[model samples]
Target: MSLANKPNRKLIATLAALLFAGSAAAFNLDSNVPITVNADNARLDDGKGIATYTGDVVMTQGETELTADRVVLYRDETGLQRIEASGQPAHYRQAATEGQGKTDAKALNITYSAPESLLTFEKEAVIEQNGNLFRGDIIHYDSVQRVVTAEGAANDNNGSGRVEMVIQPRSRQNTQDPDGSSQGQ
Candidate 1:
């Protein structure tokens, strides 16, 4: 699937898994992940259902893994949210394993609004897709929209990454996408 395409089925269904399964990886249909984490300290806020894990944290969820000094999670009114994340140089991956594909990022500071699925990384942000990478001062991603945005100038250095800021159309907006369900195969 093209990350730049605004296909509807890919986005809304992310919520289906999170609401039913205990793990996000379990909820994802196209991906399966087995991840582990090592945190020096951890805390959870009861009323808000927010958790803060810190100290050389290494967490893996399916094919996605992140290593940072800290990771904060919470549930906003809309859905799961990442409060904040910071480390010496936090590393993250999506669709990364031995052979499948790789989308990785590194940042000094990371902030996310979970409900809106907005992730913003600052201070030397670098993201990779396949063997290529994009580097910038800041990078932001919206999961619901499946859009990745970068600021302060960056390049698709390896020629493997796409430089366009994708604007994914939601299902409600994609009356033009042809799934072929209406026609015989």
Candidate 2:
């Protein structure tokens, strides 16, 4: 399907739905889950448990994966706190827990809070789920509350400066039951 990069009323509504629905509890990440990170260069400060990795960094935990040019892992005396990643456009993806789909996203800067399960994307952010695409200057997602917020950048540019989105019609296969269960088809 073609994507509508133009901004419109439907774009706003669809972006709202994507930002929220995309965070649905389909892939609830457990805090106790171990996270592994690989990078071309890494440095750790044992006193603070803060590690910085640079140059083609890849972090993974279970079905979730994040890749970036640089990634900084923050941890306190209690435990891991947050993960900050930056790149030309950092990438993130997670397998669907309850279905056969995935969530994919990219941004210049991406921050993930382990405790809150929140993800914040800054600068040319885009998220896609099932064929829908949402684009904006910033996209904030609260996994716990299942809330998403997207907004355009506030520059003195001479334009509408509105968020853009594209929503595809649901496929027939996605609407059908896998067990070939049909009541009155």
Candidate 3:
């Protein structure tokens, strides 16, 4: 089934699994649902592909959501980039993405690189992939591109300035061996 319909608590489980499959070993993260964004006065620059949301701004992607006083997102010749978020009680959330088809995750500050497909969660970053969840000061996720490296970052809680993330496992051994490890046919 498509990630949007994985029947998991973490809506992003399917998408995260599909996106992070190749980098599962490198990241070793859990399934972090999605996030939602809310902004008071939002200004969109379609030509530049930039969206500036200010005044009690809130952004949610997959299971992770963030609430800040102001948020500025801009894209230029370089690529998609985001500025820092400011707020008293910056909020975040995450959820499961797979495993037993259940998900529950959350996050706070989220910085992402659109072109590179890299995202980072810091300051009270929490993650829930499959049936497991972990909370840290920071979480980072890099989405590898066919020609570019995944250079991105983010933050969830109210930590100093760290990043973190959760990922889903999509790889499987060809067969189970007698030694306990999987053996390929």
lDDT of 3: 0.46
Q: Give the worst 10-residue stretch by lDDT in candidate 2.
A: 176-185
Tens digits of per-residue lDDT, candidate 1, 138-174, equal 7776655555555554344643333322222233222
- RMSD (Cα, Å) for all candidates, in order, is 11.9, 7.2, 13.9
The TM-score values for the models, in the order shown, are 0.57, 0.76, 0.42
lDDT of each: 0.56, 0.73, 0.46
As for model 2, its CA RMSD to the true structure in angstroms is: 7.2
Cand. 3 TM to true fold:
0.42
In model 2, pairs of residues that clash are none
lDDT of 3 by residue, 8-122 (tens): 4253444454433333211112335333457779888889777778888867655445567767677576644554464553543332232222223234565655544565555
Which of the numbered candidates is closest to the native, going by highest lDDT? 2
Candidate order (TM-score)? 2, 1, 3
Model 2: per-residue lDDT, tens digit, 111-149? 988777889988889887666677788988777665667
* Cα RMSD, model 1: 11.9
Winner on TM-score between 2 and 3 is 2
Better of 1 and 2 by lDDT: 2
